[model samples]
Target: MVEIDGMRLVQTRAILNYIAAKHDLYGKNLKERALIDMYVEGTTDLMGTIRVHHKSPPKEKENNLSLIIERATKRYFPVYEKVLKDNGQHFLLGSQLTWADVQLTETILMAEEKEPTILSQFPLLQAFKARICDVPTIKKFLQPGSQRKPPPDEKFVATANRVFNRK
Candidate 1:
């Protein structure tokens, strides 16, 4: 949720669309906007898998995490890879960045936190994530100590760094 002045916003997609509209990130035309919406929905579905992993019981969490990772890596990510392949662009919808790209980046980050090597098999998607992270604003936002969440597990971070060749 977001609060601006005296008004508040709820719902992830609604808030993202509102912000995208205000910032002209929705798209240049109706068809582009529709494409962005389609990708945003796809990202949301991916987020649902993360949510399930996070909410599973202690006894079930490990199994659930494995399943979530499998589904995300094997199923959802291929769809994104194909989209990027077909679009032939770094961004999801077109030549420019959109809310969908931003949402997908967040989903990728979440997945990486859980399974650091997840993107190794999907080079296009890996590059797509890197392209988004390379944006000036996003780079600054991702700098060390900038996020509120605790640091990722050391093992995961090490694995991710090794797989992605990050320092």
Candidate 2:
């Protein structure tokens, strides 16, 4: 939840959209928003898969990992790979960065957290990672000690399960 001036924002996508619009990252118009929304939805699905890993039974972790790798490699990555290859732009949509680009960058990073060499088969995506990482704000955030949270670990999972009362 995000609170500003006592107004609260709940729901992840609502906060994302609010921030994206505030920063002019959503898109220039309706058509661009439609595309951004679609791609972001795909990334959200991919992220949801990864999120589920945190909730999996200990014995299921390996299977969860394999499933995550499979979905990212076979289903999701190929779509962005094709988009970046066909677009020939530094970002997904065009020259300027959009929410779609950010979401794609985020999903790529999350997938790589599971498999460091995940992009080996996608040369274009490797290039995209390099380019996105070089962006000033992103570069700073990538530095050690930044507020960026790494993928949840055992401790985080434990706390989340306890706090949320998950089985």
- Specify the highest-TM-score model's number: 2
Model 2: CA > 4 A from native: 4-7
* C-alpha lDDT values of all predictions: 0.83, 0.87
Name the lDDT of candidate 1: 0.83
Clashing pairs in 1: none
Candidate 2 lDDT by residue in tens digits, 124-152: 88888889889899899989999888999
Residues 9-47, candidate 1: write the lDDT tens digits.
Answer: 998667778889888899989999999988888888888
Score every model by TM-score: 0.82, 0.92
Residue 167 shift from truth in candidate 1, angstroms: 40
TM-score of 1: 0.82
